[model samples]
Target chain A: MITFDKTTKTYDGGVTAVKGVDFTVEKGEIVVLLGPSGCGKTTLLRMVNRLESISDGKIMIDGEDSMSLDSIELRRKIGYVIQSNGLFPNMTIEENVMIVPDLLGWSKKDKKERFKKLMNMISMDSEKFGKRYPHELSGGQQQRIGVIRALAADPPVMLMDEPFGALDPIIREKIQDEFLQIQKEVKKTILFVSHDIDEAIRMADKIVLLRGGELMQYDTPSEMLVRPKSEFVREFFGKDRAIKSLSLHTIRELQDIIGLAEFDEGITDTITINVNHDLRNTLSMLLNQEADQVIVVDDEGNKLGAITIDIVQKYLHFEIKAKPTLVEKG
Target chain B: MDKWLKFLEINAPRIFDLTIEHAILVGAAILVALLIGVPLGIYLTTNDYLAETVLQIASVMLTIPSIALFGVMIPIFSIVNLGIGFVPAFVALVLYAQLPIIRNTYTAIRNVDPEMRDAAIGLGMKPIQRLFRVEIPNAFPVIMAGIRTAVVINIGIGVIAAYIGAGGLGVLITQGITRGDNYLIITGSVAVAILAMIADGFLMWIQKRYTPKSIAN
Candidate 1:
């Protein structure tokens, strides 16, 4: 857990980059700092790691004042990933991932086991890639090593500055999904910085919106999308916020609220989707005319029922208008 | 051709001794240059103003003709009572080698990817640890290139040191010139050429051996 109590940053030239911000990031939550360029979102994220020094106020990490700890020791305890991936070209993939452990003087056997486990997390073959330098791998693979290198020490807090921003769209989406799965198991407190609203919506447990170094709104993706606090927030999310919020709702939620459409047997063309798939994607499948029938299935592959475009729209209207208060979806 | 071959055959032992002398002079100068220049170059990286000034001075030193610099060294070292021998010649060669070694080290370390440096610092590496493990290894190839250049150029310049009574292969060239012996002069020139090539090849092998395999190509 981390708390920013009236945090601020003023540069040497007296230009303020971040100002008087306060928030608490709960344990195991992924809080994304979202804003336009130069909005100080990155500065705010960096302050938690003490990368950018706070000029005023205090930052508390796990109930201790961040300034009170030695800066080197403080950074070691926090995992950091950047946009460029930042893997050392001189070191092999295993060496890059095991740098922190090496610094801490871990035994060779322990380092090797951690290396293997980290490799498995990203589903990359450890034996094949361990001895290879970073350049030998593809861009996506290098970034995976970058992410795991940060996780090597198993730090309780992670700071990511657009960790996947360098990859192509397809690979970016794949890695984001991969990282989210990793987060499910590790459950580190993460403060992420990103410019893409869709990425924040997809990954953030809570989004802290900023504008010109000031806090605009800090809320869940769904709440921010459904009820924007300011005109800037509305404009930032754009007019399709109702559709955007659909991504946060899953097929299971929709089915539980209004129930799925009855499975029709006569339709020759049909496709099956998992019950946990997001409503926005399900809506896309329905609108794409890929099939005459779409069936929702439970984890056991038990066929539940059919879902159509009408049901998604019904839910969208119900979620936006009929719902009285924000209920956390996950 | 027969006369030149006979001169080479008769002078072979002397030529061998002079070549060894030449090699030691160049090698010693470059070793000292590296010890001084490399750390100085690294230090310059922290101060932009100092870097520019120091690099400019080294460049000016390089532009001075080798023999003229050797002559200048004679007067300066005379005050220390070490003029016109190995000391002045060694001093001159060391100065000449400085530009390449210092410039290359500075450029290589300065050009290390900022992201890599950030990662090193963020991962809790001390400044010294980052220098050796991250910055120096990344800068290895270019730094070796600089050393190779300095050694090769110094080999040629060391021949000129013979003018100051620093015995080397250049002694043969000067002797042949005074006595009007083309064969002896050609022998000296060829030996110096062969020595330069051998030194360069050795340094290249060292570079390939130590360079991080990932960036070898």
Candidate 2:
């Protein structure tokens, strides 16, 4: 667990990156520090491992004040995945991942075992990626190495600063999903930083919305989505929150009143979409089916609702003025 | 071929003697530059207040005429009783060599991605460890290039060292010049050229050997 009590950091040039912040991360909690750019989300994350010293306040990790611990020892216990991967240029992929363990003087046998286990966790097989150098890897592959390298030593704490930022969209999503799966198993207390709301929404077990280095709200992803605590958080969801409400709604809530016979089965298997599925996915389904109405269902196969052209229009929201707002006070 | 053998037979002893003397001076100068200048350059790189100021000093050093520098040193050494020969010539050549090493070391270390620096720190490396293990390895190519430039230029300057009685092939050339002997001038010129070629090749080999695995396949 990590705790920050009234932490403040003002750069020498008098730029206040963080101003008197208070927060805590419980053990094994995957906390995403979310914000728009220049929000100091990264600075807060760095404070956990003391990469950036807290100038004014105290940071305690695992019941020890961060100031009391030897910085090298403290950092070795934390997994840090910096934005843009940051693989050392002088090392091969295996060596880059092996840095911490090599520093700790882990025996060659244990190192080899951990190397295979970590690469496997991140879906990078040792045979294919181990011998390659950092420059030899594509962007996504480098990000994968960055993620796994941090976890290589199996530290109890993990900090990822937009680790997948340089990756393409498809690869980013794949890595995100892969990282989440790895997280579930490794169960390290994670602090992930991201400027993108959707990533924070998707990845965070608990979202800590930060603006100007101050905590706006820290809550569950579902809670943050359904009830954003501030206008900033609401705006970041980008008009998708209300539309996402359809996903949350029981299919019965949006289903048209009709006899069971009225429904058609022509596109049931290939064309119709589920209520939980996105408007973009559903639109693709409609286009493919060339049908007017699409059947929607729950995660189970039970009937939920029907999505028509009107619902698609509402989801797309060409009518700009009709939008939801989240109020913030204090 | 016979011309080479005759030149070798006539000057071989002198070449060997002068080479030992030249090697000591140039080698000392380069060592001093690497010792005092390279680290100084790295230090300046990390300090915003002094970086540009120190670079300006190094650049200005390049502008100082090598002959005039040796000439200036004569008076200073005369007072100190360090005398003219090897000391003055060594001092001049060392001054000339410092710039390339300093500039290249500074640029290479400075240009390394800050993200990598942060990552090293994030992974628990102290600043000193980061410098030696991460920054130095990353910046070596540039630093090696500086050394190559220094070595080549100093070889050319080694000829001038004979004016102060710090004999090398330069001694042969200077003696050939004053005596109006074409054979002596030609022999010293060819010898210096050969020395430069050999040194260039040697450093190139080192550069290839130490190139980081991460930067290459």
Candidate 3:
């Protein structure tokens, strides 16, 4: 676990970037630091790896003070991914992924195995891409390599500073989904920094909202959506609170309302929503199909239950209470 | 044409000897310049004030006329008991080659993307590792280009080395002028021009070969 105790950062000219901020990131959780520019979200993420020095307060990693360790050694122990992908253009893809491992003096056999495994994890053809330079790959492909390079050494804590910020919208969404899948298998403690609210809500196990270098709210996505502590947060989350909140929930959360479905004796519609689909997508499908109720199916096309507009509305209005399952396991 | 042929015949053996001397003088000067200038250029990148001061001195050195610079070197070498010979000319040529080599090295190192440097540090590379593994490879092509320019310029300045009794193609030109022979001057000037072109071509090939393929474009 990484703990920040009253951490503060003041620039050379007395500009305070992070003002005695405190938080704890538990293992196997993805915590996002969400804020506008200059709110110190980046600064906070960087401080964990000693990229940015804390002017005051202590940062502890697993009970050991981070400042007490060698800065280079500390950084290597934590994975770091930046927006620009940061792949050395002079190195091949395989060599890039092996940077950290090679730095720690991994045996040649060990490095080769790790390289192949990481390439496979990203679904990249190791043989074809191994010798290719970083510039040879597309932007999204390069970023994927960037992520696995961090994970290659299997660092417990991963720090990502807007890793997908540079990609176009379509590519960004695709990469995020792929990353979410990877995160499920790896289960490393992650400290993610992003300015996009949708991205924060989509990926974060917990979101730490910041404004003007101050912690506005630190809560789960559902909690932030349902109970925004301040008006500034509500505005920051934008006016789409209800729609955004729907993304945090999957159809399985409304299992209690499954029995409310009235099976009409001779009616069959080919359209079916998957049980794994988020509520936002299910709702959109409901409206687009002009159906009052839709059958929810499992991966094998087994009809599990049906979701109706009334049920969705009831959940949205808080008429029904369900425990928020923040992460969906595949 | 006959005059030219007669000149080559009478002076062919002497011309051959002078050509070897010219090559040695310019080649040695450039070798020394590179040994000093490239590292100095790299050092300058880390120290802004030092970079500015050193670059200014090099630029000033460049502005001084080559012949006058040769004259200045003569007195300095004579003070050291070297007198007027290859040493003075070689020293002068090396000084003249510094501006291109140093400027190019400094500029090339500076041109490395800051993001790449950040990535290097973030990945836990030592400062020295980052310089050799990251900075040097990226800065190489530009640095080589600088050396190319310096060598070509040095070949030309080497002809002036003959005035101080440092023999080269310049011997023919100096002797031709003293004897008022246009044929001898033309032959000498042509040989030097061809030599410069050949040296430039050779360095260009080396530059292309050493450039990292990823950043070749």
Query: lDDT winner among the candidates?
Result: 1
Residue pairs in clash, model 3: none
> Which candidate, 2 or 3, has the higher lDDT?
3
Model 3 CA deviation exceeding 4 Å by range: A258-269, A290-294, A305-308, A319-330, B1-14
Please, what are the lDDT tens digits per residue for candidate 2 over residues A1-330? 878788888888988898887778889888888888898989888887887878888888888898998989999999999877889878888889999998889999998899998888776789888888898888888888898889888899899998888777898988888987887888888889988766776787788888887888888875676677777777766666645433333334334322112356565443345655544445546667666566666667776545665655553342221334332221
Between the candidate structures 2 and 3, which one is better when assessed by DockQ?
Answer: 3
True contacts kept of 3: 0.70
Clashing pairs in 2: A251-A304, B159-B170
**Interface Cα RMSD of candidate 2:** 1.3
Ranking by lDDT: 1, 3, 2
- Output the worst ten-in-a-row residue range by lDDT, candidate 3 chain A: A321-330
* TM-score of model number 2: 0.86
Maximum-TM-score candidate: 1
- Among all candidates shown, the one with the greatest DockQ: 1
Error of 2 at A274 (Å): 9.5
